[model samples]
Target: MRKFYSTALVGAMASAVLLTAGCGQGLLAGDTGSDEKKNEPIMLGMLIPQSGSEAAIGPYMSNAAQLAVDEINAKGGVLGRTLELKTADDACDPQSAAAGANKLVTAGIHLSIGGYCSGATLPTLPIFAKADIPMIIPAANSQDLVDQKLKNVFLINGTGAQQAGAAAAWMAKDGATKVALMHDNTSYSKDIALRTQALVDEPGGPETAILEAVTPKESDYSANITKVLAKKPDYVYWTGYFQEGGLIARQLRQAGYTGKIMVGDGSVSPKLIEIAGPEAAAGLYATMTQTPDTLKGAENWIADYKKKFGTDPGPYSNQAYDAVRLAAEAVTKAGGTDGEKLISALEAIDGFPMFSGPLKFTPEHTLSTGGFQILVVKDGAFALQDALQ
Candidate 1:
């Protein structure tokens, strides 16, 4: 068990913003606890981007986490205590993430979950290391975070290599001869692309004609399109977010280039179609991160989510929800809020039922059984083409 001390922990816990949207006062219903346990709510900290470019995902992560907390509490609570969620906005920046993590530590939370962006999540690892709080990561699957081998940390989502390996499987199945792998300069994008490039570079794989980098948020990509089109690769992979992926897809299609544009899982959201328009979005393929509807036994969960939030679960919602649910379960299994015990419990988890899939953490603290799937854009929507091994 870890004890909180007064260090330069961010401006007290009160200074941070709460992610619980409405009716936060009654987050858990019908949980009547003993007088001693009533005053103590299990605080679980969530550090994610609530502002900045990746803010669009904040609601999905927080809402899903809150739902898990509510569900756990509704079932008589954990360890005879009600779970309370505390959130801090990392803003997808390293410095801000460290500050936000500090707020969580100062709040004396037992454990923490919710990390959307890799860059933001990387810096906060050391903070949690020092605080000795078990950190359960929902997304932010960069290799760098896992390479550190932090005992206090665990990632529920598939790592970049695992995801890229799946892409390689789909590429081989599709019989792509020549390939062009592209990425925006972000750490997350580069890491996934680099991993995929490694797989494609291996023997029995397609020839990578052009490995290129594109400026994110640029309205025009004619230069890139022209340069890459010269190689006439059979497939082009864009390992970036939805905006740039859609833009480049639109540009390439408009330029009369007939090739499969495979956007990475990070960029395969519905927003991609909105940005690329109907014509360009059609006939495109994208790798997918976990989605609620795609996961097994998640139909009821998705319906409940839609009923509660008025929208379907987004990219990493299942990951976020599972992270919270598993973390809470670990706490219960450990029989207390002990960081080392929680880590042990997490490592020992075997075929745990989650919305996304049955999960068991590998030696690297990542999911042991999972891979990405290729989704083709039909009628301007992501549709399953093939499952990657």
Candidate 2:
């Protein structure tokens, strides 16, 4: 009987060793710790336009991302390990963006949130795609971006086609005929303006009077403004960033073109009002992915953001905030930090509540549905005009 008991004890000990081996393999495979104390912090990367022409809106994005990380850490973080942010500036240029992407790739960061300019984001696409790193773009909205079929890139903000459709509908409703199209010739600006113009020229659509393209860095648009005014358009649509848009607005108003004006998401900056002057910028309409002063269900976020950054959130702040939150959520749901595991978690997300709208990615990693809001400049601030479906 004693011999039989010893054999049974040996069998039990062997089973325990097998179980331990299985658990260790699982932990190693998923980069998870068997105990809370052994868990390592997860690193998240940021690649925003911290300098160059797009710098005015960069800090708000960075601050919003920081706020998301801080809030998640305060709430015990993802899987009990802190989320670490490693930021690299893209400078809103393609070459610089590529360099920043390579730096992040070398540092072993597979998840990142940023890239404000499509021009800058375009060159980095290959870098991230080859490395299989998942990048969540918060604000780059050019239509051609997702056409590359990169498996790992995702966009929280809707595409240029979405915004262009909204803008076309609003202009048609407002009785805009003989519309003039102005763009800065950048991939993003020109794509938005051209797509919007195409929508306007569809069957039963408004007539396009003028289509003008300008250099982004040109200081004086008097020549282009004069050409647009010669068309006598009832509405002038400018698709470009804030600096160029403000310059064009001032030049157009000065050139005595007295029709309604509209700008795209690129011009939705507070500094636009200051640069164009309140009177010149007043009554201008814009379509944006988010508005700082008018986001619904974001009062708490806004207050917290202000408290932390000592400034109000900007246009893409909510989207950037949502990107970080969604990343954390994926990490927690996956129960670990493995890139493939996180990708699966992200794919499984549906109706994840966020400051923007329900968070869900299409098969191609685009937002399931385009989400944006119409905003109008009033009294030196942005007011929500309506929600676009």
Best by TM-score: 1
- lDDT over C-alpha atoms for residue 204 of model 1: 86
Give lDDT: candidate 2, residue 68. 83
lDDT of 2 by residue, 1-389 (tens): 11222233234334433544556346655445444243567778888888898888788888999998887787666655788888888999988999999998898774878888888998888887787677788888666678888766888888887788788988888889889999988888888888988999997858789899988888899988888888899899898999988888888888887889999888988888888898898889888776667776567678888898888998689788878877877765665666676778788888666555667898878887546677888999878886664
Off by over 4 Å in 1: 1-41, 214-227, 254-256, 269-271, 274-277, 293-297, 309-311, 387-389
lDDT of 1 by residue, 1-389 (tens): 00111111111111211211133224422232232244488889999899999999999999989887887777656666788999999999999999999999999888989788989999999999899899999888888899988998898877887878878778878899998999998888888888888899899868788888999978999999899999999899999999999899899989998878899887877899988899888889888766765554456678878888899888788788877778777765555576786788788887666544557888888877664667889987787776442
- The Cα local distance difference test for each model comes to 0.79, 0.79
Residue pairs that clash (backbone atoms under 3 angstroms), model 1: none
lDDT of 2: 0.79
RMSD of each: 10.3, 11.5
Please provide TM-scores, in order, for all candidate models, with all chains considered together. Answer: 0.79, 0.75
